[model samples]
Target: MKVLIAMDSFKGSLSSKQGSEAIAAGIKEVYPSADTKMLPLADGGEGTVEALVEATKGTLFTVPVIGPLQEKIEATYGVLGDHRTVVIEVAAACGLPLIREEQRNPLIATTFGVGELINDAIERGYRDFIIGLGGSATNDGGVGMLQALGFQFQDRHGKEIELGGQSLKDIRRIDAENVSPALSEAQFNVACDVTNPLYGETGAAYIFGPQKGATPEMVEELDQGLRNFARIASEDLGKDIQNPPGAGAAGGLGAAFIGFLQGELKSGIELILESVKMEEQIKGVDIVVTGEGKLDGQTSMGKTASGVAQLAKKMGVPAIALAGSITEEAADLNEIGITSYFSILTKPMTLNEAIDPDTARQNLQVTTAQLFRLIKAFKQ
Candidate 1:
């Protein structure tokens, strides 16, 4: 039998490539002669850089850039095998992980480093860009990033506003003439998975601020700042950025790309799958396995596993999802082409213990071996 193993990262425990190898090992043990293909998958979030880079034989470049808190740090982005297309994830430079739990203040965090990464790429003459917006630690509506790219945000007195989410409220003038002219020569494909608008109840601040260390008062302030920025973007820049689907992604960084760079927002999974040419590889596969660290109802909403299952269904192949934990809500995935779901854990254990690389590999192998045996019995 030919089995295709496509799995997302198990997060802190295992990477997508590691998970696929474990799954493949299990199937191999059950059927020594079985043909297996391993494909690592990600939904254009944290692991997007590694996933696309390896899958496309792309080259990764590291550059020094400012972190979320204005600290200097080394960040990485990739040039796909096509050489013309560059893939970047905002998380590399300004993600939440860069800040400690106590230091997680959205009001002060900035996306300036993200802009530096883009500027570095532009300096190299790369025009086509795939920017993944996720795991942000800021609610600045991307003003800091704009500032880094030569756009100036000033107060009513024409003084340059300081960088940070809180600084958005002081913006009264936006000077884009000094902005990088290279931007006009560029095209950005923004990989986003959420659909929250720019402001209001379900907006960036209200929905994501708490986790970014915002208090109730800060959330209100941040929301107002986003609203103010949106109004200015529409009136001054001639671009309506408010309340657009996905405008709230990455703490309103999505709006910045759409409003300033004229970027096209797309589903994260679709972009990743296309970049890897998954459609061309799914041919002639008997069974396909795909998954992530966790499987829940959200998995059906354009996540890596669901995206793989959708493609497998089109090819008339069954797709199975394996995860560290499978929630009851994951049943929703059944209607979306995932044939079945399984948890790698076989016996009860603490979350930390279960996620260890060695333990995870053993559990996955055992589960896969048993599953294959069941399939053989059914066929016989």
Candidate 2:
């Protein structure tokens, strides 16, 4: 029998590759001679580069860039399949993790490092780019990113605007003439999960700013900032960028790329699955296993497991999802071809203890073994 193991990072616990391996281990125990394929998955977010690196034979490059608060950090991106495609995770330098609990402040955060990473790739003659936009710590609507790519944002008084989301309120002039001409020569795909528009009640600021350390006033301010930027982009750049689906991602960085860079916004799961040729590998596989760190209402929304199940349904394959925790809404997944769901935690345990990932992995392996035995019995 053949089996495919695909999974997303068990965030704070195990990586996507590790999760897939554990699932494969369990199935192989039941059919020791089974053919197993492991594919690590990410939704164009935090573990994107790592997932792609683990799945594809690829090399990673590190470049020095400015962090969220202007600190120096070495952000890494990947060259996949003979360096023809570049994979980048925006969170490496400017993500929320770079900011401490005490220092979380969307008003002052920036995405400059993300731009620098792209610029570095451009300099290396990479014209095809895959950008995963997740785990951002800013609400600057990509102004910080634009700045790094040679676009200037100036106040009405003709002064250069200062950095951070707070500065967007200053009446502004946008200058894009010096912007990297190389961008036009390249193709960019943004891996994103959210479908929120650029501005409104469901927009970037109101929905995501709070987690990035924004207060009520800051969310209001940042939302206005994104709207203002979109106004200019529509009028000056001839692009109607605001309110585009997924434009609220990465704190309005989605709008920034969609407007300024003309990047393509695509679901992270779709892009990753296509890039890795996951569908081709799943053909004729007896069973497929996919999982993530958590399963909840949000999991159905362009998540790794959801993507896999959708594909499995298309291929007429039975699939199972394993997670650290399975929420009530996960039941909807069964309709998409996920046969069942499993939670790795065996007993009531603390988050840390439940996430004692090695134990959880072993449990998943054992569970799969039993599940396979049941399948064999039924077939007999």
Candidate 3:
């Protein structure tokens, strides 16, 4: 029998790759001759660069860039060995973790570091870019990124606007004359899973600003700032991206990608699946084992587990899930064509106890051993 193990990181516990290895060890204990394949997956949030590089053996490039706060920070992005594709995660540059807990302020953060990475890759002669829009610490509507790309946002008097989200309130004229000339021949692809619009009730400010250390009043002000930005962009570019899906992602960096960078937004999971050649890998496999940190209603929403199960079902392969803990309300997964499910632990445990990856891996070994035994006897 052939089994494919594709799982995301088990939260703080094992990485998807480590979890796959643990699963393979357990499976081998029962079926010594079974063929097992591991494909660790990432969802464009955190860990995207590591997953992509590990899977494709890509080369990593490090550079010093301006962080969200215009502070100097060392950032990393990836270049596939194929030489034409450059992979980047915005988190690596100006991510929330780059700032202290007390320093978290969306209105003050920026995506300028992200643009720096893009510019670096462009200078290296790469024409295709895959950027992950997650873990931002800013809400500048990609203004900093625009600044880096040479789309100067000048005040009515022609002075350039200041950095970060707060300055978005400055009314502006946009000048693209200094923008990168190679953009005409390049392609930008944004891999993300959010569906929020650029501004308003479901927009970036109202939904995510709080987590970035905003007070209720700040949320309102940030929302207004984003709205004003939308108006200016529409008037200047003659385009409406106010409600574009994923535009709220990475603090409106999604809109920047669409408007200034001309990038296509794609679901993070779908992009990973395609990146790993999962469609062909799942074919003829007896079982497709996929998982994540938790399984719940959200897991049904194009998550890695759901994406894997749906594709496996299409190819007539049975799919199963193995999660660190089965967050309640996971019943929806049954409706998504997952043939069965498994939680790593057999006994109840606290969230921390259950996810301490070493404990989880040991529990996984025992649980998977039993699962394979049951399947083995049933088949016999």
Candidate 4:
């Protein structure tokens, strides 16, 4: 029998590669002769770089860049085996975790580091980019990123605007004269899962500003700033991306990518699947195993496990999910082609204890062995 393991990272427990290896070990215990292939997967978020690097045997690059609060920090991105394609997760530079709860002010958080990472990759001759948009700490409409690319935002007096989301309001002009010339030859594929617009009730500010440490009043101010940015960008850049779906993702970084970089936005999981050529990997596989930190209703909505399951169904292959925690709502996954789902744990345990890497690995092995044994009996 041939089995394909394509599991997402189990959060704090097992990485996608480790999860796949554990399942492979279990399968080997039951069928020593079975052919097992492991393909780690991510939905273009936290584990995207690692997954793509592993899947394509790619190289990882780390560079020093400005953090969300202007602190110097090292950020990492990946270059795939093709060498021309690069994968970047925005959070590596300006994620929420970089700041403390007291320092979680979206008003001044910047995506400058994200732009620095991109610029560094560009300098290395990488023109194709797969940028993940998630876990951002800013709502500056991507102005900080544009700045790093040489797009200057000037005030009414022609003075350059300051960095951060709040600076979007002072923009009187966007001068692209110094923008990186290499951008003209680049292609960007942005992975964004949300559909919020640039500014309004369901827009970046009202929906996400609070989470980035904005109060009710700050949310209002941020929303106004985003609106101003959209207006100026439409007038100066000749593009109106304010109401486009996914424009508000990652604190309006999505809008920045679309409006300024002319990037193509796609569902995170879909982008990941395409980038890694997942369909081609699963061909002739008897079973596909995929999972994540949790199996919930949201998993059906373009999460990694569901994305893999859907593809497996199209190829007439059975797919099963193994998660760190399984929720009642995950039953919705059945309609989306997951044959069934299982939690790795055999007995009840606290969340912290259950998430221990070694414990999770052992649980995964035991559960996978049980699954294989059941399949063997069913074949009889």
Candidate 4 Cα lDDT to native: 0.91
Model 1 weakest lDDT span, ten residues long: 235-244
Which prediction has the highest TM-score against the true structure?
Answer: 4
Off by over 4 Å in 1: 376-380
| Lowest lDDT block of 10, candidate 3 | 48-57
| Candidate 3 Cα outliers beyond 4 Å, as residue runs | none
Ranking by lDDT: 4, 1, 2, 3
Candidate 2 clashes between residue pairs 3 or more apart in a chain or in different chains: none
Q: Which stretches of candidate 2 lie above 4 Å from their native place?
A: none
lDDT of each residue in 233-323, candidate 3, tens digit only: 8898875767789999988999888877778999988887787788898987899888887888889886889988989988988888888
Q: TM-scores, in order shown?
A: 0.95, 0.94, 0.95, 0.98
Measured by lDDT, the strongest candidate is 4
Q: For residues 301-345, could you state the per-residue lDDT of candidate 4 as single tens digits?
A: 989999999999999999999998888899989999999899888
TM-score head-to-head 3 vs 4, winner: 4
Candidate 1 residue-wise lDDT, 1-380, digit = tens:
99888888999888888888888888888789999988787898988888778777889999999999988999999999899999999989889988999999988899999999999999999999999998999999988888888999889999999878998988888889898788899999999989999889999999999999999999999999998998877778788887669999999999899888889999999988888888887898889999998999788888999999999998999998899999999998888889999998899999999989999888888999889989888878
> In candidate 4, residue 130 scores what lDDT?
98
Clashing pairs in 3: none
Candidate 3 lands at a TM-score of 0.95
